[model samples]
Target: MAQQVRGVIARAKGEPVRIETITVPDPGPGEAVVKVQACGVCHTDLHYREGGINDEFPFLLGHEAAGVVESVGDGVSEVAPGDFVILNWRAVCGQCRACRRGRSQYCFNTHNARQKMTLADGTELAPALGIGAFAEKTLVAAGQCTKVDPAASPAAAGLLGCGVMAGLGAAINTGGVTRGDSVAVIGCGGVGNAAVVGARLAGAAKIIAVDIDDRKLETARGLGATHSVNSRSTDPVEAVRELTGGFGADVVIDAVGRPETYEQAFYARDLAGTVVLVGVPTPEMRLDLPLLDVFGRGGALKSSWYGDCLPARDFPMLIDLYRQGRLDLDAFVTETIALDEVEKAFERMHHGDVLRSVVVF
Candidate 1:
C-alpha cells in the first residue's frame, strides 16, 4: 500500500518549502523504503529550491538523513527491512566503470529509486540528490541505504549522510592528511569543520581553519582546529603560513570551494603538498590561474566528490568511530528542528547562525 507522509517539498523554484503530503510508493526492484528518524538541512537543499542544481521542479528536499529500513523490493540483497541505516546520495552501481576498477566511491552510474514519490494530485516530485528524506518515510535504492551502528542518536548520526562526510573525506581521503601533517582548511561551515575533525582523526599535527566569521571559527576550534584565521580581517594564506612556521601546511583542503579560496589553498601548501577542493561552486564561477603555478605545485590538486566516500565501507567505519568516541559526530548538531523548520534553517545557515539544523522526525 502507498503511504502518504508529511514531507517538506519545494513546490516551485525560489519559493519557500512547505510541508506537503507526499505519496511514497512501495519499493520496486533493488529499492527500499526508509522510515526517516532525522534529516539534516544542508545548503544543497536550499540550492535545489533556488534552482541551482536543476530545473527539476517540485523537488522533495532534504538529504542528510538516518532511518530504519521499513521494506525492501525484489532482488534487494544489499540492505534489508528493519536495518538501521544512513541515507546516502551515492549508491555505487557495480557495473559502472569506476566500480569495475575497484573504485566504487567514484562510481559513474550511481542511482536512486526507480519509482517516484508524488504529490497528492499525482504530480511526481524529484527527490533531492535522489534521496528525498525530509519526511516520515522515503524510498531509495537499496544501495543508498548503508547500515551502521544503531547506538548513535539519529540527530547526530544523520550528519554523516552529507556535509559532514564531505568534509571528513576531503581531509582523510583527498588530502591524504596523516599524523604529523599540517592541514589548513578554508571554510568553517559544517563541511569545513568536518574536515577539521577529519584532519584531527587522521592525526594531523596542526589544523588551521580559515573563515570570514569569528563565530564559525570558534565552532571550528571546538571541532579540533589548532588555529583559526579570520580571513575577513587578514590574508588567509599568510595566516596559514605563519601558523605553519611560515612554510605553509602540508595539505590544504578548500572546504569553501571558490576560485579565490582555491587559489588560497593552492598557495597555502608547502612544496609537494596536496590541495583538496570539497566545497562546491556555482556554474558561472570559474578559476583562472597561472599555468606555470599549476605545474609548479609539486602535489595533486583534487576535488572530493561526496567526500570520496565508499558509503558501505566508510559509513560503518565512521559509525564505529562515533560509537568509540573518537569521532565526535554528535558535536556537529547545532540545533534540532521539526519537518516544517527547513526554510528557517536555511536563513540561519545564510547568516552562519548554526553549524547544522537537523530535522528530527
Candidate 2:
C-alpha cells in the first residue's frame, strides 16, 4: 500500500525546509521501507538547502538515521521487516569495478531504491544522499539498511550512519593510525572529535586536538585528546610539531576542509606520515603548495568518504563499541529535536555551537 507521511522537505533553493506530506511507495525491487526512529541533522542537509550540493530542490533532508525495517521487496535478503537497522547512503553493488577489486569501500555503483518518493502534489523529492530519513518513514534500497544491535539507543547509535563513522574511519582506516602513533586533528567539530576517539581506540600514544575555538578543543579533549592546541593563539603547525618531538604528528587529519586548514595539515605531519582529509570543501576553494614539499613529505594524502566505511561491518562494530562504553557515541548527541527544528540546527552548526542536533521521530 502507498503510505503518506510527514517529512522535512526543502521546497525551493535557499529556502528553509518545510515539513510536508510525502507519499512513499511500497517497497519495490530490492528496496525496504523503514520507520525512522531518529535522524541527525548533518551539514550535508544544510548544504543541500543552500544549493551547495546542486540544484536538486524539494530535497528530502536527513541521512544520518536509525530505524526498524517495516517492509521489504523482492530479493531483499539483507534485512527483513522488524529488524532494527541504521540507514546508510552507500549500498555497494558488488559488480562494480571497484568492488570487484576487493575495495568495496570505493564501490563505484553504490545504489538506493529504484522508486521515487514524491510530495502530495506529485513532485518527485530528491532525497539528500539518496536515503531520506527525516520522514516518519522512508524508502531505501535494502542494502542501505545495516542491522545493528537493538540494545543501543536510536539517538546514540544512529550517528554511526554519518559524521561519527566518517571521523572514526578517517583515523582508523584512512590515516592507518597504529598503536603508539602520535595523531593530531584540526578543527575539532563532530568529525574531528570522532577522529580523536578513533585514534585513542586505535591505541595512538599521543592524540593532540587543534582548533581555534577553546570550547571545541576542550570537547575534543573530553573525547580522548591527550593535548589541545588553540590555533588562534598559536601556530598549529609549530604547536603540533612541538608536541610530537618537533617532528610533527604521525597522522594529521584536517576536519575542516578550507584550503588554509588543508595546507596546515599537509605541513603538520611527520616525514612519511599520513594526512587524512575528512572535511567537505566548496568548489571555489583552491590551495597552493610546493611540488618539492609534496615529494619530500612522503606519505599518503587521502580523503575519507564516509570514513571508508562498509556500513554492514563498521556500523555493528561501532554500535557494540558504544554499548560497551568504549566509543562514547552518546556524547556526540548535544541535543534531540523534532524534524521541524532542522533549520535551527543549521544555525547551531554554522555557529559551531553544538556537536549534533538529532531529530527524533
Candidate 3:
C-alpha cells in the first residue's frame, strides 16, 4: 500500500518549497522505508529549490538525515526494520569497476530506490541525492542506510550524512592530512570547519581557516583551527603562507567551491603539497590558470565527491568518536527547527548566521 506523508517539495523551477501530501510506495526489491527523525537544512537543498542542480522539477528535497527503518522490501538485508541509520546518497554497487578494483569510494554506479515517489495526483518526484528526506518518511536503497549508534542525537548524526562527512573527508581522505602537517581550509562554513576538526583529529600541527565571515571563523577556531584569516581583509594565500613559516601549508582544502577560493587553495599549498577541492561549483564557473604555472606547481589537484567517504566504514566510526566526546558533532547543530521552517533555515544558512538548522520531527 502507498503511504501518504507530509513532505517539502519544489513544484516548479525557482519556486518556494511547499508542504504537500506525497505518496510513498511500499519498498520494492533492495529498498527500505525510513521514518525520518531529523533532517539538516543544507545549501544543496536550496540549490535544488533554485533549480541549480538540474531541470528536475517537483524535487523532493533534503538528504542529510538520520532515521529509523520502518520497513524493507524483498532482497533487502543490509538494513532491516527498526534499525537506526543515517541516510547516505552513495549506495555503492559492488559490481562496478571502481568496486571491482577495491576503490568503491569512487563507485561508478550508486543505488537508489527503484520505485518512484509521487504527489497525490500522481506527479513523480525526484528525490534529492537519491534520498529525499525532508519528509516524515522516505524510501531509499537499503544500502543508503548506514547503521549507527542509536544513542546519538538525530540532528547531530544526520550531519554525518552530508556536509560534515564531506568536510572531514576532504581533510582526512582526500587531502591526506596527517600528524604534524600544516593544513589550511578555505571557507569556514560547515564543510570548512569540519576540515578543521578532521585535521585536528589527524594531529595537524597548524590548521589555518580562511573565510570572509568572522562568525564562521570563530566557529572554526572552536573546531580546532590554529589561526583564522578573513579573506575579505587579507590575501588568503599570503596569509596562509605567513602562518605556515613562509612556505605554505602541507595541504590546502577549498571548501568554498568557488573559482576564487579554488585559486587561493592552489597557490596556498607547499610546492609539493596537496590541494583538495571539496566544494561544489556551479556549471558555468571556470578556472583559468597559467598553463606554465600549472606545470610548475608540483602537487596533486583533486576533487572530493561526497568527501570520498565510504558510508559503512566512516559513519559508525565517527558516531563512536562522537559518543566518546572526542569529536564535537553537536557543534554543527546551530539551531533545531520544525519541518515547516526549512525555508527560513535556508535564509539563515545563506546569510552565514547559522552553521546548520536541523529539522526535528
Which candidate has the top score in lDDT? Answer: 3
**Tens digits of per-residue lDDT for model 1 on 87-179?**
999998889789899999999999999999999999999999999999999999999999998888998889999999999999998888998
lDDT of each: 0.93, 0.93, 0.94
**Cα-based TM-score, every candidate:** 0.99, 0.99, 0.99
- Sort the candidates on lDDT, descending order: 3, 2, 1
| lDDT tens readout by residue for model 3, 253-301 | 9998999888899999999899999989999999998988788988899
> Given candidate 3, what's the lDDT at residue 225?
94
* Clash count, one per candidate: 0, 0, 0
Model 2: per-residue Cα lDDT at residue 220? 92
Clashing pairs in 2: none
Q: State the lDDT at 350 in candidate 1.
A: 92
| Pairs in clash, predicted candidate 1 | none
Off by over 4 Å in 3: none
Residue 219 in candidate 3, Cα distance off native in Å: 0.6
lDDT, model 2, position 176: 92
